[model samples]
Target: MFRRARFAVLFGVIFLVILRYYTTTRHSILDVTEGKTSGPWREEWGHPIKTKQSKGANDTVHDESDEYVNYLRVLHRKHGFTNDVPVATRRIKAKYSKPPLKARPSLAQVKNPLFKDPLGFTRARLDSDNIWLPAHAEIPPLSLPIARTGPRPSSIDASSLLFGISTTYARLTYANNALLSDWAAWLTDGRGSSNGAGLVLTLHGATESQVKTIRDELHHLGIDVTLTASAEGETDAGGRYAQLVQQMMRQRHREPDRKWFALVDDDVFFPCMGRLLSRLQKFDTSETHYVGVPSERADWVIDHGTAITYGGAAIFMTAPMLDTSGQLLCLQYTKTSGQTGLADEEDPGVGMAWDEGLSECLARNTPDIKMDVLPGLFSPTTANAQTNIDDVQRGGGYASGALPLALHRYRNYHRFEAGKGHAVTSACGEDCFLQRFLFKDGWVLVNGYTLTRYDGGVTAEKVTVQTPKKKSGGADSKGAVKPSERLRIVDAEDVNPKERYALSWKGKKKTWRLLDARVKENGEVWQAYVNRRGGGNTVGGDMDDRRPGDIVHHAEEEKSDVDSVILLIWEGEGEK
Candidate 1:
């Protein structure tokens, strides 16, 4: 009996020893403190580390960049919330009229996906400052009152000149209409959309029903826009852009007080129409003046053998220039594009962009006319030749002392399209968007862009106005000048220019990016600004981070389901 008992104890001891070994091994899987692991999951789960090899430095930088977008920052909190989320277009039951209907353009490509309820939120009133909102993605679509970006303009002066803009139905986005509505705040004089500046939208290939929807919607928002079907044979397909002046010339008799005919890309925004009107006033409208900013890309200028303007930078043609050059330029577009076989499949009737071929035609036809260069309007070329993304915009202090009248390519890299009106324009108007204001609390509010507090603190006057130095020339033309498949002269590189500016922002800085915004019936504006993450690289953003084979970085934690979001509430008119 004694021998048997002793044998049993020895067997028990060996079993315990084996169990401990397996348990310890299982625990090591969670131990990612050092990032070194045994299996083939190093590259996927491990952070890039520096090595002693020659290529190590470059590899580390490249790999680290790839990982920066690995974790997507979200707009929710982990704890203390019930599911009572607010409606995006909430209005009082009485005295609310429904706005017209237009499709909301999706900006999914530029921004990260927002994960909404299924999760809940704590109920709160939007009565004061620091109002933490429910998940922005959770807010429902418009139901009552007008969900347009801002208050409807009481008056718009359509008698001045027709402001023409062109875009395809397939390519129209939420940002497009948002910008159209925003024009009331900047371009229109007095209250609602004014007749001083009429808007003409040439929607290419859109169905009759689609055109009506957009027309009715803008009219309901108090914007009197002229909607024309720009099909191949009609005003559009590319002919409309070249012949817009001719079309507007017919209406000139009705709008006898009209001055200049301006054509801009759908993406361009006029911060203050007064500022632009002031600029145009400097030149002679009677003369054949072709005024515009040159293409920020130098290579395109070199290749074309002359300076060409990008439409997004806003192309203004004097009354005489447009009236004289209109029809001829359209014919030239057809003749030139057909000869070069540069007919675009999407824009079937037209050959190339009207800006390029039309500008070239204007030059050849009117040899005496030269481009009247507009300085300090568009953002200067990037400081470094290697980097892309130009514009005087740095952390919301737009064009500083340059006295900017317009802003372009906001959706390109900065993803500012989603934030455009909601960010600053809704509360302060376009003039206030991205403008910097320093508070006595050592905090700085860059309008709709960022709300930050520097380490030591920054002063308003100390924020000196500086501009990017122009490069010596377009991309080096050395070595055979390989013919590219497309005519793209320059494009924004993968790197975000906001990241470049982040270096100059001293101490701990937080970018309160606009997540969602809504205007109440009483004229109050509610804006949600959330911390940004996933610089367009995160993989499992909407899903739980605890999935298999996906490892969170050492700095990231699953402690909460979401990051904190900041909400700002502006009092409506007469609410005080």
Candidate 2:
């Protein structure tokens, strides 16, 4: 009986020791897993825990939350703040508001086949998303020649151009700054005298101090600015144009030496101002010339059966044209109001849309003005079929040779400034795509299609490269081109290094040039339709055998090995 008792006591002792060791070891393992010994305490969501500073340490916790809020407040005061701030801030706060719930492995979930393997399930979902691409691929070798920055044309002077910008007080420091910088670059360049170039800011709802501030900002940009108020008490959106016209007339009277007066939107980007000035230099500034591309509203109310110059792409008027209109154009514009057409639904005389209103005034007042419909001088969106990118790609007998001049309604001030933020960049799909077209560096990829100039000059090759297209009904098939996608250009190193392609009209040569192949920003080569001076155009003859509306291709097709479908050429002294 004593032996049995001793054995039981020994077993009990062993059980106690094992239990103690298990408890201590389990705790140690958990501590190591949590990294509590070697690192600072972290929350469940991987954020550092906020700790109170102890009296022993000299260091104190510093919170810049207030400062950040104040900085945003100041930005709001100076420039309008972003619209998504409240929603974004609240969402972030909500995400870290409480501790993340530890997900327990439920038997119900385990039973479901879809959730049987967590890793596999996640992989499947990611595959379905189609957002992720393969990290590396065998991109075909491209041989694009590096473009040379040629000498600035001594014949062309940009300072002779007068720019009248239409903007509001709020946008001066924000959206307009980008354009102001470009203009400043041209003005600061010693090639053109500041006296030859001038800037006029037509502002609405700007105070005297605000105007002064804007003036100072322009002065800092190294250009003298003339600030003018929009016609007071005018309730029409078109009233701003009246104000600008009036201001331009006054300036025309004041500065007779300034040759070209261009009315561009505050966001209008003239990538090649020197080339533009050269084109303008060909025309007589003393003659009444109305130069711009035309736009028409689908509603057929205001600009019905008439081609009106889209103001955003920019409208240029020679001094003589402005002189001929005198004050009649301004008076007519002011008399028209946004509410004029709304009052009578039955006979809504042309609504006070700036483009339509300006068209009416010019047509009625200045009959002697020469209207130059250079569709290439404006953005492609100003055309009749605005949504059709194929119209541009096909280049069916339009001014296919002339590069696009300005991108209208392409505003992306959100990157630099604050506000609701224009979606121009987003709309273009990717940075590369935007840079290729809108922010062009004088080259465009022409794949499987030829573009002919208006004068029946250049014809492209007829060859197709087998490219992969997204399956008819897939996730990636729906959206525009994916971001950061690189497109390959075939044989883009075949242009004379010294000779530039120039656009010729009526025996006069302009600096505009077109090349067959050109290099893009990412060192990729493209069978490009390159023009030294970028602008839009409408061809007159059949660009290719293919009919219009049949040239639609998927954005992903850019990755395909397409042939040199574009035939671009330079029409000048040396290029053949």
Give the C-alpha miss distance for residue 2 in model 1, angstroms: 54
Question: Candidates' TM-scores?
Answer: 0.55, 0.42
- Considering every candidate listed, which one attains the maximal TM-score? 1
RMSD of each: 18.0, 23.6
Cα lDDT tens digits for candidate 2, 78-197: 222222222001000001102321210000001111101111101111112121111112211211111222112223245667777767766656433544444543443322235246
Candidate 1 local lDDT, 294-325, one digit each (tens): 32232133242122343344677777877777
Instruction: Write down the lDDT that model 2 would get.
Output: 0.35
Model 1: runs farther than 4 Å from truth? Answer: 1-159, 173-192, 232-237, 293-313, 327-350, 375-403, 418-430, 439-442, 453-508, 518-524, 532-561, 570-576
Query: Against the hidden true structure, what lDDT does model 1 obtain?
Result: 0.42
